[model samples]
Target: MLLFDFMFSETLNASLVQSSLVCLATFSAIIWWLRPSRSRSLPPGPRGWPILGYLPNIKFSEWCNGYQTHDVMCKLAEKYGAVFGLKIGSKDVLVLNDYESIKEAFHHTNMNDRPENAMIKNIDNLGTGILFSCGDKWKEIRKFTITKLKSFGIGKRSFAENITIEAECLNSEIAKIQGNPFYSRPLLEPATLNVISSILLGQRFSYDDEELHFILDNLHRNGKVVGSGGALLFVPSLQIFLKDKIKEYRHNLDVVLKYFRGIVSKHQEEFDPYIEKDYIDAYISEMRHNKDKGKQSYLDVSNLVMTLGNLFAAGSFTTSETLSWAILYLTKHPEIQKRAQEEIDNVLNQNQPRLEDKPSLPYTWAVVLETMRLATVGPLGVTHAVADDTRMFGCEIPKGTMIMPNLWNVHHDPALWSEPNEFKPERFLNENGQVEEPPQLIPFGTGRRSCPGEQLGKMELFIFITHLLQKFNFKEAEGESPLTLEGSLGLTWSPTPYHVCAHSRE
Candidate 1:
């Protein structure tokens, strides 16, 4: 009995020793993981607990959330100056609130590459689509796209011809409303979608078509998902644990990618390189040619799919939002609207307003400028990641730091503009009554990764505004506030749903 008891005690002692050793190993592992890497030094900001980072502080509600993000970052800028740090789940992002810091980080070539985020990779893999690609691949593809866009009539006669058709269609649709308070989605979406569709697929859909509706809805939803809670993308392992949200994201991407794939597959069977018809056909031909020569090409089938996706999604949102805001503002300020109409009518004299006419109609241009400033989409824009450790505004931003350019802060900065909150077009006009472009209104962002679609976007806005204002006087629906500027946060800031009645100039 004595011997058995001693043996039992020895076994118990061994077990306790093993448990203590295991605890020590686990504690050491935690310490090692939390310890900052010896590679590079990072900028300073609020510290977070291990693993989760500052994600707990991220509020996801749309209305309060966007403002909260803007305000919090602004406060941090006050405390930390232009450059500061933020953590979203084990990841640190350096936020750039002022123009000087933004230019230093974004405009310089060293900081040009896209960040190493899973979502960015997912986007790149799903389609080395223009929005997410980096390096020589990006430069080659972008150069090709720029060349193609220009050749196909960006700032050329072909583009003008297409815009005229879309303008006519938009005008005809508005005329159908007969001066009633009709929701403009049916008319506006098709017009905007076709601007891209004609460029990409060489096709256009009627506003009432079911397929177009489905595509638009899916695009809209995907944009919302990507723009919000997209930080989920950076932590892919969480996808396995949080299966439902990732599944939804996958489903949305699959739906759009599948649609694009179908288009590409059809083009592959019947595409003609010699013809050089539409964007996809040109890409398909290029892809095949590269494959034959054993040279890697950016215009692969996946890229074609994503390129169309990027073109459709990116092109549609900002233009639509800007137009929506312009209409709303005109409705609120009737006198300004009247003056714009007068300028369009007097300058063009029943002729379609050309791009060159933009200079002649200073007030008309001012209205567009004000719309851009007041309704800057992506108030936060897309979150950009640092390519490497860098300094901005005297702060140390480590490599792999995500950069958020606060375009909202830039557009609304009281230091830059007088009465920053007011919707004043006159601010953009010089004492000489000419439209003076301000570098401070950075609606399109700046630097190596700035938006490539700026000229197209500006053209679309000018054409749409010219046609709409010339034909109809926008007015508030009864008992509605025309000055109401509510935006739902997404990959872009979109106006909250509202209706404006079109009063015909007839």
Candidate 2:
């Protein structure tokens, strides 16, 4: 009887202690909520649920469809005006619609950091690469990559020659298809990969290389998965809800990383820093130099992998997808197609088109520009995060806020362009029939985190598209008369599978 009574007393005391702790926690939360430093004026936005944010308004159905997603966001921008707020999962994202706002927001150094999301958040090592990294690490890598790419022939004639050769190979591959209805991916992908791969590893994969094909296919699949933005992509913990998808994501990334690792490992042994070869050699030299200083933070193995991964992913898809758009647009508009062909023929005249001819082939270049504007490759570019408390055009954006620059809105704004819906390459042409670079045509985005691969991509598009038009004509398949402009939006937006007959001009 005495033992039972003593146990009951102990239980009661434990319950009382638990109650006190709960009360203390409750009080602390209340005090924190009321604290002046804890609250600030967030931009106007729709309120969301406890964990899930404004995802309800931005429905999955619309997101799954590329065109529909833009249409929805366009409507929201119309209602929300130039600046509004949203909560993508836990991310407090601020949408900058107009060109001026986007320019100003992007230019702010405080707004330069890449937003922390599931994609980078769950990375084995957080903030390691050029694309998803933040702060000094990102800054260091971006600058280093741009400088190295220049030395390795990215924006130079030598690089253009490399792309031209790839174009020749691509033309040959397309010829093998014999003008039959075929998916453009298999042909376009390998050629694009070869260009970037040559720049990175100093070698290009043959079209029939099975291992290379595996990397290309998975790279594309991963790109699409990343493009299909999700809660887990923005909120890492939500990955718990997508066990199967997370497994696939990890597997795909592993395959690509393993392939790159093999290349990087090979380069580590054969790399000669004193003699410049490619991006890999240049990076190894940097790592070697920094080793003595004990400041080799950014030039290690993992970083090399992530940076190369991004370069591969970014350089490959957007350019190829833009080419896909080119085929779709030009084929659909026979008159436009004829004009482009005329320009190519006049400029080259029995010679293969070169980057030197880009300036001379104004209409052909204009077609490329218009395609970029019409179906912007990166519609919602890499999301950025606010570094500190900042203001943009009177909107108060607190620290840790995410910035979503709607390239679609900027490209399609009625106030910015007349008849924005119409496919008019001539708009990019001047009275003297020269190609004019539109200040607002920011398909690759603007400011700090904007695509460093833009110049390379432009050169590739011009060389490949012009050469293809020079060699053959892209035609509609028997039943695929009207090529649908509808695209499947992923990390990059690409056209839906459509059959095109490549007719040899010879």
Best by TM-score: 2
Q: Which stretches of candidate 2 lie over 4 Å from their true place?
A: 1-40, 60-67, 119-127
**Model 1 over residues 1-506: C-alpha lDDT tens digits?**
00000001122357665885477457646875666422224566665434445543444221345544565667667887766676655677667788877877788775676555464453445666776677777787887787777777888766877877888898898888888887765577788888878888888888788878878888876665555556655544333334555556678878888988988788878876688788888787777788899997667777778778878887876787788888878888999999999989999898887777778889988999898988777676666766666665565667666667877778887899889878899999888999889887788889888877888888888888898988899888887655467765566666777888898887
Q: Please give, for residues 269-325, the per-residue lDDT of candidate 2 as tens digits.
A: 987756777788888888888997788467677888888888888788788888988
lDDT of each: 0.72, 0.76
lDDT of 1: 0.72
Q: Write down the worst ten-residue block by lDDT for model 1.
A: 1-10
C-alpha lDDT of residue 283 in model 1: 81
Off by over 4 Å in 1: 1-40, 60-68, 117-125, 235-242, 480-483
